[model samples]
Target chain A: MYVAVKGGERAIDAAHAWLAEERRGDASVAELSVPQIREQLKLAVNRVMAEGSLYDPDLAALAIKQSRGDLIEAIFLIRAYRTTLPRFGGSVPIDTGAMTCDRRVSATFKDAPGGQMLGPTFDYTHRLLDFKLAAEGEVPAAAEVEAGTAQTPHIMSFLDREGLIQPETDSDTTPPDLTRTPLELPATRDLRLQALARGDEGFILGMAYSTQRGYARNHAFVAELRIGTVAVEMDIPELGFAIEIGEIDVTECETVNQFQGSKTQPPQFTRGYGLVFGMSERKAISMALVDRALRWKELGEDNLGAPAQDEEFVLYHADNIQATGFLEHIKLPHYVDFQSELELIRKLRREAEANNAAPSESAGASGGNLSGKMKEGAAE
Target chain B: MNEKTDPNAARKAWLSLLARCSAADLDALWTDAALDPDHTVLRTPEVGSVMVRGRAGAVGSAFNLGEMTVTRTSVRLASGEDGHGYVQGRDKVKATRAALIDALMQTAEADAIRAAVLTPLQAGMEQTRATRSAKATATKVDFFTMVRGED
Candidate 1:
């Protein structure tokens, strides 16, 4: 039985006081403001926003400051804060086709419609540390050119025209919200995508890497990856039509996987899609690969007993908040439970010793019997 | 003439503009315009979130992408016009001012408000977009193929 324990109030208060002082960290150093974190450390803010499933950079920055740069802890703070706000409503699906392209690239095409733009990427940069960044220095302004007037079309649409890729059917039916309801097994593609979008980036990336290593390998090619800002709109009952509520930056990845077909059907390329908040291209791409791997069952491909193919395993462990909570809870006081186990172990040892002393009297009650009893007690 | 054909279209345009305008810009514009009409808060500014949705493959069924912070409110002017504001982030004052501007846009003083507030805000928004677009445009790659000596 669990017993109520008290008397840590004063100690706990003192500990917190000391923690706050430590969090301030060398008062001589200039303090980091929330705005500075939001603006300068934007990639960190994006990760928190994507994982925390909330898109307020200021709050994410504040959480980062409070957590002293522990991203998971910052995500936890954002998640907790999210529950307090009243949800106004769901926005109408954002039109990514109309997105103002910042960085758009395709691996399948040499020159896709609205030509490849490598906006603010670090792909080609040498890994050598830029010591100049340590000191304040003025950087040159980014060069500018006249904006292109041509439309930037989705590369997959080109394949769709030739019936080369599997066509995704449009649906107006409302999707089941994972947040509103507990996640059940055999989750639909929409639900799986929702979970994976906010899933832990590192976990998803690992799962994706596993797939690339021939674990349920679906020869995936990044059809396109684009990052840009899109307007968010919602239909207002009072206004009688939809209006642009706001705009948010997002990264979208589309992967074209190897074809799947039977005797009755012609071969067509399968697809996996990922859309996430902010410029989280890595997370977005990983999500697409993992998403494709999870679709083996639906796509009529054999399940290779891969971890990524197991939807339950991926979705269950992908949430770092839940994982960290359960894992860290063990460090908390379990005095009663541990004491019971200790007493059980001592009792078993005493019984074994008694059996050893009286072996002639109880020849049938051997060390094996004592071990079996100990196992049962441990189970209890 | 466009407004006459679709009466709500103009309001929609101005509301969209107001929602995208920076809070600082709106505050400055509000003060410079020197416009303060008697108004009642039909609903006080409340900070909340709206679940943003996106389509699968940019064409298929919609799924929840995430939630974004938004502040919204409804206000009615003494002249009986009601206006609603929904702007990004948790700026309560911006929401209130936006609602006031929205209401003012429907009144006889709309042209004056448009000149003093909405026009400048639209220009600022356009300038920001143009600058980003220009920078992105500069990054466009012009791939060239090299021919072998034998070929």
Candidate 2:
């Protein structure tokens, strides 16, 4: 049994004061503002929003400042804060097809419609550090051309037209929300996507990499990866129509994977999709690969017994918040539990020593008795 | 009438414009517009969240993407128009201002409000979008094929 102990109030308050001082980090230095963090460290803010599952850049920035740039801690802060707010309602599913494209690229097609634009990418940049940035060197304004008015269609649509890829159908059924409902095994695709979208970037990246390295190998090609802003609309019951509530930046990746066909069906390419908040191309691409890997059963492909293919393993361990919470809880006061374990071990050792000292007077009887006591200690 | 001319469409456009514009910009426009329509707070300005959803493959069944922070309020102008404000982020003041502007738009002052507030907000949004889009367009690839000597 765990016993609650009190009387650290004074020490705890003092420690918190010390922590506050440490957080300030020398009064002489100019303090970091939340707006500065939001504008400058945008990628960090994005990650917090994605992982925290809350998209308020300002709040995310504040959390970052409060957590001293520890992203997971910032996410924890945002998540804890999220529980206090009332939920307004669900938005109409965002239309990515209508996204105002910032960066659009395709590996499959050489000249896809809405031509390949590598807007603000780090893809081909040399890894060498530019020391000039340390001096806060000013960057020249980017070259400009007239923005295209034509719609940039999804690359998958081309394959869909030719019947090259497996078709997907839309359903009106409301998807199961992981936030509101408990996650069950053998989760639907909707649930899986939701989990993968907010899953830890490093974990998802590793899992996606495993697939590329021939773990449940789905020969995937980046059909397209686009980063842009899409309008978020919601239908107000009183208004009788949907209105654009806000716009959010998102990165979408679609992977065309290798074909799987049975006797009755023609061989057609399968798809893996990923969409995430902000300019998170790496995470989006990784999520798509992992998503495709997990579609083994639905695609009628044999399960290769890969880690990525294990839904339970991926879903259970994907949430960093839950993982860190449980992992960090062990560091808390386990004094009572530890004391009980210590006592049991000591009792076992004492009994064994006594049995050894007794010289086996009743060798079999005493030995069995000692062994029984040891087993009892272990059980305790 | 087309979407642009429809009253509902006009409200949608203005509401969207209000939501999309920066909070600072909106505050400036709101103050300058001087649209203080006496209104009852049907719903006091409150902060909340809306679960955003996305489709798998951008074509399939929808899945919850995540939640975005939204602040909303409802107001009824003394002139007998009900207006609601739902905007992104946690600015209670902005939400109240939006609701006031929304209510004001329904009154005869819509033309003046549109000219003063909505027009400027639209221009600002367009400028931002055009600037970003132009930069992206500049990065569009211009691939060329090389001919062999034999050709």
Candidate 3:
């Protein structure tokens, strides 16, 4: 008996095996340990943590390693793993106001309430690459000191004190969780913030760039950018008090937006906010800009038909994993769609051929080109 | 523990009433509760109202598609507290217990129900898991058993 070809299973197995071999590379090369990735490849780990919405650098490192350095896949793994962990309770909101900030800077003010502390930043580093380190990685320790100088207060709070902006009240109301529920059209500030925090850093950056490039020009300034740890606590009924669960390092950015206030309300500086899981400065800034663009309506600014201004456009397309998955999955089999199009072409061609068999363009042809039937009918 | 009355127990009672009552009877209850506007469904509660879904499917066969009797009611206590209870299946007692849990939960008795009801339910679930694991262990079939007489 003859058997028909069924190569899919075998092909899949072979492909996976080949991929595994490639990931490991030559046997001579030392295999990359998770710790090595975590410590040395810390930036990649940070990106995964920021986008993944999971704070574990080790897990992100392992995911990155397993995914063969595909950052998006690493993020996808983190998100999937995050869903399995049950939430015992929620955290006490970290008062970013009371943040013992390591780094604080405001472009608008030369000297603000809290003194400026530029904590461990690569801002002033020359673009020149160090070739000496490439030979054998060893750098003479640069002088280091504790960034204990500035106690920066939220710039928005400073403006709020003068009654120059909408007062944002901190509350204990159950905030919207996007992971647990389907995203709705009319989202609250909480949901929007959640989306921005986990959104693709690059995508948010470009959208933000577009806004600045005359798209939805809302003059925004980096009012405050702070990076620090915040206490997480859970309410214990037995104890009748919230207990500290853990502390997580976060990067928060708040942008002061220039917008015309409504009729009742006076023109004041509105705000845009970004809060992410790690020390991700670029992501934080981009998120803040996009956040401001999305808040056109709530702040009483008119939508200027910008892509960044559209809430639906930005929120839906922000996540890299979702975007990449849908984009890449198109490489899968699409023979059925191709076949349908082919059949439609053949049918259209047959009709055209039949029409062309007999000359339709005769005398008294009006309006446009006509088939033979039209002219013959006119003669009859 | 309010020995006299449990809010969850009351919810259970209403749930059973819904499952047992006809469409007309449900409408009558709705009318009695003055819920036509709200569908003030003293509405014949339905089980399986909550949808369980995922990328793979229903958390790995933990459930199946089926109709469940559900009952729900909005109650007003003498002290003027309003609460809702929805319970699954036709068991009036369970419905009542769930309703009691809901009502008490809304009031200061939230911790009490978590202690009394949810904790126990979670314990029962854990026990079930243990049993399922133990049974699987007993009937353990090693699929990778080597062939003794091979060519």
Question: What digit string (tens of lDDT, one per residue) describes model 3 on residues B38-102?
Answer: 11223233222221111001011111110112334444444444444443323344433334444
The local lDDT score (0 to 100) that residue A255 gets in candidate 3 is 80
Task: Give the poorly placed runs of model 3, Cα more than 4 Å off.
Answer: A1-6, A146-150, A262-265, A358-380, B1-151
Question: What's model 3's lDDT at A45?
Answer: 88
Model 1 steric clash pairs: none
How well does candidate 1 score on lDDT at residue A13? Answer: 98
Question: Residue A277 deviation, candidate 3, in Å?
Answer: 1.4
At residue A59, candidate 2 shows an lDDT of 94
List runs of model 2 lying over 4 Å from the truth: A354-380, B1-7, B148-151
lDDT of 2 at A261: 84
Prediction 1 TM-score vs. true: 0.94
* Preferred candidate (TM-score higher): 2 or 3: 2
As a TM-score, model 3 comes out at 0.64
Q: DockQ of every model listed?
A: 0.83, 0.85, 0.01
For candidate 2, please provide the TM-score of chain A on its own. 0.92
Q: What is the TM-score of each candidate against the true structure?
A: 0.94, 0.93, 0.64
RMSD to true structure for each model, in Å: 4.4, 4.5, 21.2
Q: What share of the reference contacts survives in each candidate? A: 0.81, 0.85, 0.00
Question: For candidate 2, lDDT tens digit of each residue in B1-151?
Answer: 3585676987887787777678999989888876677889999889998999999988999999999999999999888899888889988888888888888888889899889988988898889999999999999999999887894
| Residue-wise C-alpha lDDT for candidate 1, range A69-119, written one tens digit per residue | 999999999999998999989999888988898999999998899999999
